[model samples]
Target: MSAEFDVRYTAQLARLSLTDAEAAKFQSQLSQVLVYVEKLKQVDVSGVEPTAHSSEMNNVFRADEPRDWFTSKQALSNAPRQANDLFVVTKVIE
Candidate 1:
């Protein structure tokens, strides 16, 4: 596709308003990117595995385990209002 066509089509897709000079600028940049993509397509990758990222990754989160936490009385100690060991707030739904 022509760079002009690509620029105009992309701007339309993104709901962008571009002046003539801005469109021309983007057309040039888009052409360069397309050229680089074409160059990348020529590289040999028969032995390389496809991956989502370039580096090894492992889960960084801690394992889920049971732990002691605040009791009902301690949790409700700072409540502005409470009834029967439960928080009291304005009813949201009619």
Candidate 2:
């Protein structure tokens, strides 16, 4: 079955350049993976529930609420350089 799955042709399809040895190695690895997947099919999953994640997902974000915002002076206090109530970053373009 692994022989039928041509690694060289698949690599070409993906525009990948693989040496003969590399292709052979990948072929063996892919075959082992497929075999494992096939073995998984033999397991009885009738009683198990299908789930997208292994653990429950909940939003980690804090609730949006109106609060006292920073003043312009407070905001610019930590800046290394400031002019006209704005941070003065170094010129990036000529």
Candidate 3:
């Protein structure tokens, strides 16, 4: 289960600098990870169905229905200032 990936090349591509000792250490550690991944490949999952969750799931949403909205007069009735059916605001910039 030897990892054959070029760690130095990978480090260079990732914009990292490593000493020889660090590169050797990482190569060994990465090889161990690959060995575990290879072990997972040996597991039998052919009979298992793929699912996003372990429990039964259902959507909990309310039904959508259209209703009447406030008219322009009703919306502007509470405005501090109004002119020509529009809300009047103070000038903010010169």
Model 3, residue 5: what's the lDDT? Answer: 79
Local distance difference test, each candidate = 0.84, 0.88, 0.87
Better by TM-score, candidate 3 or 1: 1
The most accurate candidate by lDDT is 2
User: For candidate 3, what is the TM-score?
Assistant: 0.42
**Candidate 1: stretches off by over 4 Å:** 1-5, 58-94
**True-structure lDDT of candidate 3:** 0.87
Q: Write the per-residue lDDT of candidate 1 for residues 16-49, one digit (tens) a residue.
A: 9799999889889878887777777778998998
State each candidate's clash count. Answer: 0, 0, 0
What TM-score does each of the candidates earn? 0.45, 0.42, 0.42
Q: Per-residue lDDT for 44 in model 2?
A: 94
What are the per-model C-alpha RMSD values against the true structure?
10.5, 10.4, 14.6
Ranking by lDDT: 2, 3, 1
Give per-residue CA lDDT, model 2, range 28-54, as digits (tens).
Answer: 999888777787778899989889767
Model 3 weakest lDDT span, ten residues long:
1-10
Residue 50 CA error for candidate 3 (Å)?
8.4
lDDT of 3 by residue, 30-92 (tens): 877877788777789998888988788777687799789999999998999999999998898
